[model samples]
Target: MALDRRWPLALFRGAVPVALGLLLWVAVTGGEQERQQTLKGRRAADLTHERRHNELLMAALREAAETEDNVAHRPVPWRK
Candidate 1:
């Protein structure tokens, strides 16, 4: 009687590693997405802060420009 030697062991031999690899892939993808979301949130906060700082600097510059214009338009006391 010839023993059938390629059924139960051969089918499972290839399937187990493929199944384990798929599980590992799913876990790694989920972790990477979570990390990307965290970085995006931090980037958004940093941009908001930078915009506020730029606005403050613009207001100070405007005030200085107005002061300079006022001084330039004033009459010279020694000549008048």
Candidate 2:
């Protein structure tokens, strides 16, 4: 009867460390996953902004080129 009481106490002592270790492992990995996800989202947003900026630059260039072409076809009063 005394041995049976010791068995439960001994089991509880051994199980506590294992449970704590698992909880720590879960917390560490969960934080790492969240960090990685945040990095990925930031990278995606940066790429999207860059793409939009490039598109706007392209549109401005096209408009400038068209204006230049129009000017080239017109005669200037000071030029022959």
Candidate 3:
């Protein structure tokens, strides 16, 4: 009878700490997921901005090349 009464008390003592540890683990992991999501969003925005800048530079270079070609094809005033 004494052994049976002691077993329930022992079980309750062990269960309390285990339950508290699980709660703490859940809170930490939940915060980490939010941080990961925020970082991913920032990286995606940076990539989109870089792509836009690259396209603008390419268009400018093409316009410059066309201008150069037009100048090259014209005859010199001295030749005429």
Top candidate by TM-score: 1
lDDT of 1 by residue, 1-80 (tens): 87678877987998999999999999889789789999999999999999999997787567767764554455676121
How big is the positional error of residue 36 in model 3, measured in Å on the Cα after superposition? Answer: 0.7
Kindly list the per-residue Cα lDDT of model 3 for residues 1-80, writing each as its tens digit: 35687888999999999999999999888789789999999999999999999997787567767764554455666131
Model 3, residue 42: what's the lDDT? 99
- Residue-level lDDT tens digits of model 2 in 1-80: 35677888999999999999999998888789789999999999999999999997787567767764554446565232
Q: Give model 3's TM-score versus the native structure.
A: 0.45
* lDDT: worst 10-residue window of model 3: 71-80
Error of 2 at 21 (Å): 17
lDDT of each: 0.81, 0.81, 0.81
Q: What is the lDDT of residue 28 in candidate 1?
A: 84
TM-score to native of every candidate shown: 0.47, 0.45, 0.45
- The global Cα lDDT (0 to 1) of model 3 is 0.81
